[model samples]
Target chain A: MSRRPSPSSSTAVPAARYLIGIDGGGTGTRARLVDSAGRRLGQGEAGPSALGQGVDQAWRNIRQAIDAAFLAAGLTPAAEADCALGLGLAGAEVATRRERFLASAPAYCKLALATDAATTLAGAHAGRPGTIVAVGTGTIGLARHADGRETSANGWGFPVGDEGSGAWLGLLAMQIAQQAFDGRSAAGALARAVWRTAGGSRAELLAWCEHAGQQRYAELAPLVFETEADDTQAAALLAAAAQAIEATVVAIDPRAELPLALCGSLGRRLEPYLDAATRARCVKPAGDAIDGALQLVREQIRQPLAPGIP
Target chain B: MSRRPSPSSSTAVPAARYLIGIDGGGTGTRARLVDSAGRRLGQGEAGPSALGQGVDQAWRNIRQAIDAAFLAAGLTPAAEADCALGLGLAGAEVATRRERFLASAPAYCKLALATDAATTLAGAHAGRPGTIVAVGTGTIGLARHADGRETSANGWGFPVGDEGSGAWLGLLAMQIAQQAFDGRSAAGALARAVWRTAGGSRAELLAWCEHAGQQRYAELAPLVFETEADDTQAAALLAAAAQAIEATVVAIDPRAELPLALCGSLGRRLEPYLDAATRARCVKPAGDAIDGALQLVREQIRQPLAPGIP
Candidate 1:
């Protein structure tokens, strides 16, 4: 139903000779190339390709990473018709962005698209059933059931959601700073630090708020972690964030059977705050999202096309 | 120290025969006119003039309202030289905005500026000693002591501050709607209503958040009020907002000795939720902020220039 150009039907193309798995995010993009036998040929990295940034930028980064992988493998770069692709990208959950991203894909023989969280989960478990809590500037929990069903929690974005993420912690810090500014609450060290960062004046804070977004707020999270030991407000904020993260994990995989991995910069930091029972079930991830992307492409090549599809 | 132009010194102008008191806010600007004896001459209204919007827009709205007031009074529209001005406008508390606004003042014979909260308090008490809780899209409490000293609580802007304000209610509603979307919370009537208004899709919500501001969030407040009776989340949100309003009032005047008036649309709505002790101390305001503005100008004329002035 999409108006954009579609790749030629599988029957009209030669079988792909190479598989490329891409893990694309807001910070950067990574590519892993594999031969037909599933052996890793090479890996490469490039700048951010977050789908939310825009389809063009995402594709540009994706292409650069793929080319780097080919160069490292010491082989001529594969044409789009010679490769199959598996992409786990940030902002792929939004339907419109996902559609446009798919439509923009090069004429690869086969392709699969999913959210970064999905790839993270697959990577953590090495293509097995497991769960993952990714807590950076945003927070999301993903679980893959034994039956291949998947579920997600949180990851609703900043301000309204992402309760246990960096942005959430920063928001709490800002509120405490405001309360301190108005004398409604005590000006603890954390509050004072944030206030000084805002130029120690209400006017400066106003100006900051006018343009403040998730990245700007996330910059304050480090102060929360630094001051949590001595500042009551900061400690409380961390505790609440940990609780939210725990809730997300429970919501995604209530049964404690599957291996759970805490991923991302803020994810590991929250480990100490999680309850002992939940912490007992946690396991270190077997691989990264880029590994999961490779696994995805391998599966796509084996299946080739869904049943009943010509 | 401001680089902007300063108004001509008060001693250089003739004694003013008319006073114009303007209450400017984000929604609209209102103006009241009075003669030497303090008799009401006329009233007029114009578009929003909140200084946060920009100095040029604020002045444009203020001038329009003043002109409308003169027309209503059936008097030749007085030049700025013929009238002294008193303005209690939103965003006036920020020093930069205050200075810029003062510099942009039309050549009024004399002018005085105060925050809208201060003017609301002054108007509520008719320049006497009293306290007031003003809660519209934002919330602030102000108290004037018998000694002519004044203090304020809250009034921090939206999202980070302004707890118990219209925008606060709207923000809570949005969060609840998001929780419902993620299946983390039940979708009650309020959540359903909000989601429907937002096009009931995650992509649409993401699109909305990209451009959402205080005004956009504040628009959700009406749903909270309408659903509060039957929806648990809505009721809880209102109760919390009321508690915040109560806290602001208590923080401003702990003893509850001063006459207290609850002003603004959201403020009056919170009255039913206030505790018996706090509600008992509440009194109806004698006049609106426009009247308070007139009183401000009247007082300025009586005192003329300050004692140490040129």
Candidate 2:
């Protein structure tokens, strides 16, 4: 949705009018608009902006979302250049992709970039010391220690690592569908669901996979949750997914000293499947990734964060 | 290696100077030349000729090997058109690829085509009824019943089905490398071998996968066999592969009545891992896929079979 700042907010443009915080991931991009005084102005969103999907596509989606946020804020497109931008994006850890993403920058007053995992941790803990397990289209666990030393787990990519992620779950589901098609396994409820969506015949399934990527596969993940109640195979998949999430929880904070929060839509949905030990460590996130992105630019520009607003 | 027919065989030109049988797969192509009287002449080899790779590449490799065979036999390239050609090609099951391959046929006097799996089954039984599991770069179990009915299992494609094939083994090995890199699993010998070959860094690994296909992954499969003795993970992968092969065996012949032959290099290597019950159904093939391809055209052209020669 587009958001436009009110006339009063636009009038404050030169001093503190616009701050755009972007959370760009494999599935979509979200932009949160705020004034320099930390007042929430508006929010905007666009399609996938993961640099790994290609730098050009990432830039296009980011620009679209930034423009959307400006529109939502009641500001003209030209006002975007006056806004400070903080972007926490997927694939930001890869040096080459990160470099390319930054290199293709559009005009802005100021800008900062970091991995989405980093911002997720910052947002979950509200700039405090805690760990976050992000389980959206992908999965990653990151911890920001009180000492400022950071550690991470997973976040590897689709079809390989990123265990317990939506993509991983859906990938495994596809494997099951394939096995069923080959008569190596039975066509259970989950398989039926996959077949219905992916095409029933082997040739059709192959054609479906020919163009499928991480985002397309992740779209199938909801079936795992939807069918888990009645299908043993689906339940097993969910259990394995939970185990993967638990591994990330332990891998990032083996000592169990840090407060942990599941920070993505799927992560929160997988909550009931977690072990008691992991559940005990879980805490509600104080802020969202957008807040952390905003916090990122605020720190860089030395702007004051509204007291206790987060 | 190229095989050229002897001068005496070349003299029999109009009647039955040459017959070429080709076994073409994802890894490489082989051409076998024989005279009208069914006497073995020479053999030639070339690179991958799988039609799914591209019709042009397949035709290129086939032509290279055919020319090599004619050259080896002390015959000129011009003699190729006078030969009867029979091709057992991987990806022949893909209708589009098969159509393209046939449409691009050279001026061979007579030509016939079938899937490599079908040819393997025919060759394994020397034109009799039997079951064959061909597990080279890809895997497929096919059975030709006495009644002329056929059944198949697996062979869906690489990185999907294909079960215990070389590419499947290598693809699984890649997964281990990825999981180890992500700290989701320990780095075992298999993972170490993969990292050494694929590159040690995450970016390097991702780059390795960027251009990797079935053939590239199959190159890493030998390590699974080489390291299985001292590495539990590698052993586990082999055991799983064996199980997949066994599943294919059962799927194709539930009654275990048909004589079964494992037709690929990996399939033979996995023989020792098969259970005694599954192994009991196994038999050495009477001929290879090249032999079957010739027999196919020999039947089609109503050529007299040399008595008792398979």
Best by TM-score: 2
**Candidate 1 TM-score versus the reference:** 0.85
What TM-score, computed on C-alpha atoms, does each candidate reach?
Answer: 0.85, 0.88
Candidate 1 retains true contacts at a fraction of 0.47
What are the per-residue Cα lDDT tens digits for candidate 1 across B1-310? 5242224445534678888899999999999888867788988899999998999999999988988998899987787888888899999888888899888778888898888888898899899999999988888888998877776777778777888888888878988887777666678989998888775887787778656778888888999989988898899998898888787777777677798899999889889998898899899999999878777876766555543454
DockQ of each: 0.50, 0.41
- Writing each residue's lDDT as its tens digit, candidate 2 over A130-232 gives 9999998888889888888887777766655678988888888887887777677788889999999999987788777767777788889999888888789
lDDT of each: 0.84, 0.83
Model 1: lDDT to the true structure = 0.84
- Candidate 2, true inter-chain contacts retained: 0.43
Angstrom error at residue A207, model 1: 3.7
